[model samples]
Target: MYGNQWSTDGVVVARNGPSLVSYRFILKRSDDGKLFKCEAFDSEGESILESSVILEVFYIPKISFSPKQTLTVKENEQAQLICINDGNDQNATTIWKRQRTSTIVQNNCVLNFKNVKRTDAGLYTCIVDTKVGVYEDNARVIVLYAPTIDIEYFPSTKTMKCIPRGIPDSYMFKDWEHTTEYNDHLRFLATTKEGNNATLTIPQNVNKKDNNRERGIYICRASNNISSIDGTFAMQKYNLNLPGKPHFVSSTENTQYGIYLETTEIKIKFVSVPENTNYVVYKNGIKFTDYNESVLRNTKIIDTMYGKNVSVKGNILSLFVKLYTSEDFCWYKIAVKNVVGCSNYSIKLFSASLPGIPQILRAVPKQTEIAVLWNPGFHGGYHRWFIIEYRKVGDIYWSNQTTNSPNSTVIGGLQPVTIYLIRMFSRNRIHDSKRTEEILIQTGNVLMQ
Candidate 1:
């Protein structure tokens, strides 16, 4: 029979012989044949015929591989491998080696690759052979760099877009800055999808803070699990203003029965007018009703039609010639006469003749009775009167009559066999003038006795 005891600190001994037995423990070294005492154990009780002993202790060092965490090196760069061993033993020597390389780098334990290619990537290990034992550890080394960008201009929105070179899982976008003073609250936006591409939009309406402001440079950094790249673009500015000049197209007059003769249809062509202004039309001295609406609210196309009346607000100053059926007539002395305190602007009707004598013109059939109508000039004065006079082709003494109203009378007119001259003059207290021209009448004997 044998007796055995074990301790919590990894020591065990057994006794069956008359003498006590003790055991020495050591860890094996890999690089060189060496051993160090890891633990020791001795039998405490008396031993009889046989005895056994066991001592267990582990020898481990603080070992680490070079380029500890992560690295970003350009392609074809010269990189170095450094192995470090932080343990209690100073006689320990480290061996630097890679999973793919068979040549073991010893002594200084520093591995240098003059030009590292992507194929030279692997798990680098550092093995330390010490007098006590062997220890080792490893780290993963990576080779990668940032990306470049190509930019193009989008004219429609006055924006610039940046395109990155490679596939990226995520991206970061930032506004460019010329100096250290930065306004981080730049109004910009960026969006991306899984496969296609990314885009950034700058709103059309920017606040006063961003008005007339240069679109600063923008940086786009794209990242995948293995690598990252960056691209940049310059800012752009947009202009917002109104359009220019206007032109006239065409005009017209209407002769529909019973419609006021001077009330005509006018067609005009022109450019778009800006909002908020008033447009008024005038015929002779009378205000026509072409445009009672505000110009700003009207969206009429250029070269459109409009209509208006000849007399507005009861003012009788006809400057425009009225086109009649199968005939064209020009009348003068179309003087707009007004009495005192009338406060109206008058269009001088020149007699179409001498020393400026006041006169009215008529185009009628010879020997036929004709009626003349005119608006009484703006009514304010004490006396409103018109004088009607006519002379035969060769007669010098004028047959004349006076009337208080704009309407007058003619009697015993001849047949369609003679040409007569008719004239009307308007008079007021302030001044007197002759008509613009004489009315021409040629009579025809169709129904005459």
Candidate 2:
């Protein structure tokens, strides 16, 4: 122990015997130095032994907000935040940071903002340095402002989105209401919140329960401890007035036609539509205007081999041909469009100048021959006859037969249990049509007697 200069307060000393001694004292703030010492003397009072020890203390750093306890400021106004620290170390540092961003707003003890905006509204933290370690405390900086709303509607999805902007971006604390003035109550379909923005969505469908309501409007009211704001927007539904696509019903002449020197018109029927809706006719994907007017309006003969006409009346669309040419031989497409939009084209309509392929009705295998029934399509331009050709499946040359009747035919001298290929073509004085696709048939075996 030190000499009599050492204070007796909070200090104790004990001696058990001639060679044992102990000293104790409570550590204090001023005792944080290495100057404390103990000494023992012999009978001569000379310095026998001496010792010294240093004292140190550890503690948690104290942190505090400078301006006030409840920190609230108006939006777009000047503001400041000061972090006051009370500790033993004078070289300690202070930092200020916001919740959403990692950018350190201030490194010193004070943070200053010229104009505080709504984005600055959030939990702010003040960090203080201490001898043991760094410590942090949080304080809320609330910026108050009126709510703003931006609305967008998508027609195809039938959805409307309303985005609300304000302080305290929480959907639970806000009141979302949708209504129509025509005594119809609308529904808030869904709500989503991300970052500082909250969005409310509603469907664009009309309320069938209320007959007079055609539109819906959304209103949102939001509030924080500082202030309250409200926003509203009206929703509209887009209407499409275009009619559906037109379809081919029945044609005066079937899709295929026979080649004839005489002028003939083909009358066709189409699916009906709204009388006011206009239709655009296309030939092989090309607009009908590309052809001569006479070819599209009414039939007029220019020469023995040339002219064409196309016309539309109510639900019936017709095509007139005075001569056969490639321009008049193709498909037709009809589409309808109105104030709203255009509809897709109907199915294609085929027109051919040559004889159409023949269809087989029935084939009867007999004892010595096979009886086949058929029908000829268009004969080009005349009541031309078809040349029926058939042969065994492996035969290179086809057996031929002529028929003015065009419906049924029989081939004799065919072996039983044999397969044959049959095809036919129409012929006239001007041109010969291509052969039709081949049909296959097998002959039956003879019955046992």
Candidate 3:
């Protein structure tokens, strides 16, 4: 097979088969050309195949722009623009132009806009031209300026509001505020609302130095992907209100003596200005050291013994009396005092009964006498002496005697081998008491003289 010959400075962009031998080809012409026919031949130079294929040649020039859209600059600032073309031929040329310009400002593609003005904001395009084709692209450019801030102060609540201007939705507000040690304490709260506005609340509590100093400065900052804004505010002077004083109240109870003369639990009540102020309880005109938080909250003291013969005092000036006794006639008096105001109150504890009589000692039997001993009974407001009576076993009549000692007494004239029953009792001014248990005595087997 045979075909017409076509030629130019061309290169194979792609190929198939190994070792660059027995290969197929994808060719591109350095310069544009008209379609032509081609033929396939064997290594022997013989035409093995023939076909008419379109010989299309093209040059797709690639174009790119850096810092695409939205350029951020400070007030009265400058900026730079860059463009590039990655086409096969280095002879390709680039052109840069702004939206409203027919003539290209920079034919080199890299454009620099120095000392940029607000009017410089617009879309910019870059064009690349090769021997085969032309390519172009456009990018939007935005210029950003610094923002302003306004702060409002609320004196009564000690709060301030910070409003930022010129900050867009893509931007974020940042805090960079601080208060000196000698200055008032400040706290911050921030919120965002409609219209892309951010509000920051700052509360400052007046301190000693704040009263003397006329004002202070607080710094705040806002930032976005494009640029940043910083501002400061001067705080005004103001007075601080003080809290109110707490009130004190009082109550009391009777006193008592001994280990357990009175009930341990004592109740007291009070009122205050705040209504729910805390109260401290005291004991015996002193603070109750053993007071537990749980007991105070519950208003009941459990298992705690106000010591014997002691008084309970409360912070509110209430009193509690503790009572303990070993004697039937012993008595106690209780006094309570408020802890805060030192107010005093009192209550009495009393008990009445004949003192317990000593247990009678058993009698010792003798040949002609039987002896017994007992301590005298405690007679508080009662009779002093006790009567002793005895009767022989099987006898209906009793022989009576009297003694005042808490010591032993002997009965004579008793016959040997005789059994007797003896008993004793006391009669107080208040009442006659029952007799003690009768004692059984038997005489020894000895002759009586």
lDDT of each: 0.42, 0.56, 0.50
| Better candidate number, 1 or 2, judged by lDDT | 2
Which tens-of-lDDT digit does each residue in 1-449 have in candidate 3?
12222222342233222122222446655323433334344555465544444444556766666675445544457677778666666677888788767978788877777777556667887878887777888766666544455665565554545555542334455553432222333433354342433444444435422221212344444544344323322222222222222212223233322224543334333221222344444333455444222223222111111121211211232334343343321222222222222222333333434544545777888898878787666653333566778999899998977776656788888888899999877655444456788888899997545
Error of 2 at 87 (Å): 0.7
TM-score of each: 0.24, 0.33, 0.28
Q: Mind giving the per-residue lDDT tens digits that candidate 1 earns over 1-449?
A: 33433232333332223233334434433413232222223355343333223333334677665575334454467887777676646667877666567767555667676776565566766778876688777655565433345555574665555555532323443442211012222334454433433455545544422222223334444433333222232222222212212222222111111112332222322222121122334445455443222122223222221131111111111123333332222111111112211111212222121122333333445246544544444322223467777778988888776777654445346545667777776665434445646776766666544
Model 3: worst 10 consecutive residues (lDDT sum): 302-311
Ranking by lDDT: 2, 3, 1
Angstrom error at residue 250, model 3: 45
Highest TM-score, which number? 2
Candidate 1: residue 175 lDDT (0-100):
45
Off by over 4 Å in 2: 1-58, 67-70, 99-102, 152-163, 169-338, 341-449
Measured by lDDT, the strongest candidate is 2
